[model samples]
Target: MRPQHRVSARIYSVSLRCAASLALALLVSLGCSDEARPKAGAYCKISEEGQASACLAPAQHAYPAFFRGLAQDKLSDEQAREVETDIAQGAQSERSYEALSTLAYGYYRLARAASSQGTADPETLARLEHWNELLSKAYASSEKDPRYREALRQAAVDVGSRTPPLGLRCTDADGKPARCDSTEAVVRAMDEARDQTGVRGEIGRLFDRVFGTRP
Candidate 1:
């Protein structure tokens, strides 16, 4: 072979080896990540035949888009309400912890946005109360699932870091508006709910065992 051709062949061989090494590394990295990821439970899984229930479809398709819209501030009130209705319907039927948590977080985002505007409307206050109720339900439904618990905890921390509006209000048990007033109070409630034990926790575990659902 000519010297130039020999040199070119050697360079090509080196490039091929480097490419192979990188591909191998990438595969190994991906394998590790997959192993580390939490396994999807029955409620969160689509059948191999690509079938999904009405309750599961919105969670798979609309939940992520809705949250993305919230992050980008591109979601209109009507769109948000529509997504909320879809998720709420799914949560009612499926009782999936993931769906419950997603719905709770959406409410929190809406409440935060309304609070940030410096005035808490009646609708916003209602949503805030619903958010708390949903948070409790989500945490309870998580059962022994570490992934669900972690997601709830992280969301609480993220929202709790923000200062609440000075006049933030939430409905009391009597359906009267009461000053909630602080993010700290909200986070404290979330923490307590997440760590709840005794009858409530036992009931949640029993429900999960019966339904075979995971977030």
Candidate 2:
């Protein structure tokens, strides 16, 4: 072969080897990631053929997006990481109530689940406390609205203990007195109350005023 052709061939061979090495590294990294993750078959009840990982995610990450993504069929590692970053960022500001609440409730629910399985640990306990503090900020930002108060109360429920009475006091859209015995019911009642009182419009206005429109 000509010297130039031989040089070209050698360069091509080096490129091929580099590509193979990179691909092998990627496969090994993926295998390690899988091994680090809790096995879906052991930790999850398969709601669908491929939903086991999604179902097991919230237990591992303790984030609302993971649970919501399971229902929406969009769960992913990237989404979980995004939610974690969002929550961390929101923790430093009063304007990110929605994100903070989501994360706080996610941790609350996860802690409940962990408690039930007798797997609650110091790390989880510290995280739950941190989220509680963040939730407190969100609640206070809203002027201690009855709805937010009930949300915190609901999160405080000890799932490992005997079921406690929920005893949520609320009002309907027509300002009718309402009561609930569960956290979900409390949220529903608050939603109905907001719909009735048109509080959501006010909330929207407040958001716009506080956070401004995204340019």
Candidate 3:
């Protein structure tokens, strides 16, 4: 009877081992499944150059990753140049509101970085103007997007605090060219344009809440 009991125990142990092996195999198969793989057009599947070249494509959804990579200092000089070229092309082509606003943001960041070091260079001044121009275009294209309005307000505030003035431009409700010369003025204008009650405005607000606003 003891011998039979020992044989039964052995069989149970063997069954447990088999079950464990099967479970491991299943996990491995799932890990290597097609669903687990990056798609053919996935951002990670593209080379750095390829990613930069295609950065402006609306379908690529590459800006977030590309800018994140840039912030991490992951891109080489050549790759950075490619990305810059793509941004310029996008701006020139009036590709989309996203592209235009992204270009504006790039210039804004560059100008701010340079200004933080010391007196701004001629290049930095030019970049700030470009930022203003691109941002205007973006805002015109997507007037309902809160981000662009917020950007304009923030830039006005930032410039207001600086010496020698940024000389940024905006249009009044009457379509007259108005100078974005003060934080109060810009914020007031932006407030007038605010529309968080509508579906589009609500969606924009929701996105800002989820994303916590761009840097």
Indicate which candidate wins on TM-score.
1
Q: Estimate candidate 1's alpha-carbon lDDT, on a 0 to 1 scale.
A: 0.52
Clash number by candidate, in order: 0, 0, 0
lDDT of 3 by residue, 111-198 (tens): 4455466655655455455445443443444454344345444444444443234444556667687665323344344444444467
lDDT of 2: 0.43
lDDT of 1 by residue, 57-113 (tens): 546464666656657534545645554453344323343444544454454456567
For residue 170, what is the lDDT in candidate 1?
Answer: 48
**Each model's TM-score?**
0.42, 0.29, 0.32
Ordered from best to worst TM-score, the candidate numbers read 1, 3, 2
Worst 10 residues of 2 by lDDT: 37-46
Which is superior by TM-score, 2 or 3? 3
- lDDT against the true structure, per candidate, is 0.52, 0.43, 0.46
| Comparing 2 and 3 on lDDT, the stronger one | 3
Give the per-residue lDDT of model 2 (tens digit) for 1-215.
99999999999999999999999998878767723322222213223222233434545444545667535423355544555554444323322334433443344355445456565554445444444444444344443243333333333332112222233344444557664332433334333333334556466345445545211
